[model samples]
Target: MREFVFALEYEPGCNRVADALADHPDARIRSLSLHATDDRLWRVDHATGTSAALEDIEGAFLNGDYYADCLATDDCGATQTTRVLDRTDDTLVLYSTWERTPTCASVPHIARDHLGDGVLFETRHEGRHYTWRIVHSGVGDPAAFFDALEAAVGDCARMEMLRAATTEADAPTGDGTGGASGLAPEQEAALRAAVEHGYYESPREVDVGDLADHLDVPRSTLTYRLRRAEERLAKGYVADERFADAPSTPL
Candidate 1:
């Protein structure tokens, strides 16, 4: 297996969404970062670090978190969110959510889908939404990976609205959405900025170019790095689960 990472940036006034995300299923509170905004939510994931045997992949789709939060303002303010899952060694679904709408005109290569061993991430802040997905399959052919990731992000971003992929019958609440340990300074900096900038509003306007500029890297590069941060979060959850099952230390 190879390694890949994905990350996302939210707008200024969409803090509420983040609050809801903290409680999302498939979220793995042990694997996410929580921003202090009522309207925003941010996340990162490393999509390539898993060692699943290629033969283990089955033709199936899994649902992650399902979250909802009230929008004080806006006509279609009320919303629920979730993520999609696939375990194909040939392909992986990095990120999926109903947090908020995307703002980019054209999806960046990093956010596409169908690439092998890639990562995907999404975030909402200040009403502006951001998504990133990457692929680093051992095949070393990121062209198709990039194209697919970009298309996925683009398709997801342009969505008029996002719906929860699950129903209460399946999940009463949902997955946990928290922070992972290995978040880079840059990724954390972006999260901090989203908080400091007041970009966590539901309908807040955000500039992807501006955020890229702030991080001092191309949007694609930043997206990859952010995904790495998310991997750490996801790994943290796995570690915690294992630790939970392990024998406890003597008092």
Candidate 2:
């Protein structure tokens, strides 16, 4: 199967649920179960935040014309039926089945429209950014899907295509034979956090100290993990045939 990964940045005012979440930067929603058909979208989400955030989120889900992952909605649009599976002061579990309307456009619908069936979706909603990991049996052109999604989203949201690749379904995820990023789990975690937080960006969005605090790890530990991860990546890169074929000279 192939995987098409992308992200959407929901600027406030474009989406009610995302707007309600704008104030709670630390709040996050994780997908538990999700499926979509031509007529309905069913989802179960795990949300964590303060009471205020949860309350606003709940209202947005069941009240006025709110729908997650939808770019637009209009009057007389079909509303969603939502239930609170569980709620706590800082966490909420929600189950919703939404009726699809022609006035609205969502990621899953667009994907099905373009990419066809036999696709699975996983999502992560953090702050203003939502990342979607879609797996399909190579149904449609990922490039076309990206363009369609961007055009459909228009000015309501920003789209970034992270990955568009085809992989064997039975391929080993990682053989642990020290090939292609054979990092220890801790090292990989630290490196991923660093990259996600822009540690490697030019002019550096974050330093090791800042990233350590972000991950709740000690400064020294983070530094070591990053250093080791970088070493492995650099060595692997230089060892590849493409690099070996390039002209190089010792300084």
Candidate 3:
């Protein structure tokens, strides 16, 4: 089994859902579902944010145009439909299905085309970056996949390869020195930047945007690193059994 992970960094306002995240900067999106297909890309997003922000996200999601960025052409005449479920004050659930087009497009369709069928997709969207972690059952050529992905991304967004196969640095433990456990150097740097920049202070010494500026990286890049770091640290505080039966859903 191989996990070919990659991320897409879109220009602000280039992606509708990403643009929506920009409007509600505090909202975070996570997907966990296996539901997808060649003609349809299914998404089940669990959104956390202020109620107003969730509402806005819901509206933006229901707007079919929110999916234009994923299609081969804005006028490809593809169709997208969404449904809202499990509404809450701080969290909202959204499900969407995007039908495919003849033109090679979308991470899901393109991945299936090159990587073979049954390639699972998972995504996290916030701000300009839409991160995808694809789970493929068989060994595949990541370079070939990325080349196809890069062409599909084209001028609309910048693409970066984050992590694919596990590496020594990705080990659950670090060198037997005073170094903290697990965190990749980049992840650690992101957390350090955030803390030093007062990102954790009340009212925040600076929001993500300003902190990102201080670090001289795009906001999407900073957020991706920070979020990955936090997830690892947070898991350290919980019991392994707590997630023994957790669902692994794909976006």
Candidate 4:
């Protein structure tokens, strides 16, 4: 098995992510390691027993405080947990370390494997600090792995840039002209609070059911409203003005 280790730095004054890690029933502390006076990281073990299914990790990262904690959502729901080392409140450093596990059969060479073509694979971010790696195995060429890695890295970089831009600005100034704003006046008032509540920043932490309760709307209705709001934001705000006048088409 090959191993790779890397570190992610968190901006300062954003440590409330630690609170998200509290009380997650499914949360597990795989392995913890300390590097220096201010650096500590964790290695999450994804392997699970047969009866208990593996849960998908939605988002994980160390906040500005440098400790690794992340929001996770499975097919069932979302939870956030801080997976930090004990006895240290210093800067959190999330690390990734891997080793190959024994399998019943010998691994086949990527070059020789015919199953490599026309195959699609999916990945899930495991531990905090957005530690991403292969979550599933399919027949493939090792060379193809490079393409996937590049795509993931690019996506991460883009997301980080967008997040930084949003943080610097005042809560986004929506004109409220769209009929799809879905949020009630009270909910709209609470919109800015959503980031602090871990909503806007982490979609995985959003509980549609809970949001519906707070908004006094049906869960489905809440979902439709949120979806429409997202659609408008993607099409109107995120897209360039050149595409603004284009009509929507069925995919």
Summarize candidate 3's per-residue lDDT along 1-251 as a digit string, tens digits.
56655667777656777777878877888896735577777778899999888877787777645364374536466677888878989998887777766653777776776778767777787777777878776556667778888887778788866555532344354432233645656668889888887898898878999888888887768877888779877886574556776887799
Q: Tell me the lDDT of model 1 at 70.
A: 21
In model 4, which runs have C-alpha deviations exceeding 4 angstroms? 1-196, 238-251
- List the pairs of residues colliding in candidate 3: 32-249, 33-249, 33-250, 34-250
TM-score of each: 0.25, 0.67, 0.74, 0.21
User: Using lDDT as the measure, what is the rank order of every candidate, best first?
Assistant: 2, 3, 1, 4
lDDT of each: 0.35, 0.76, 0.72, 0.30
For candidate 4, give the lDDT of residue 116: 38
Worst 10 residues of 2 by lDDT: 170-179
Clashes of each: 62, 0, 4, 9
Predicted candidate 4 versus true structure: per-residue lDDT over 140-239, tens digit per residue = 4444544333342332221110010111133254432322443333333334334445566545476667766775754533443444345545675656
Q: Candidate 4: which pairs clash?
A: 11-64, 20-80, 21-81, 21-82, 60-129, 60-130, 61-129, 66-92, 67-92
Best by lDDT: 2
Q: Which stretches of candidate 2 lie over 4 Å from their true place?
A: 73-76, 168-251
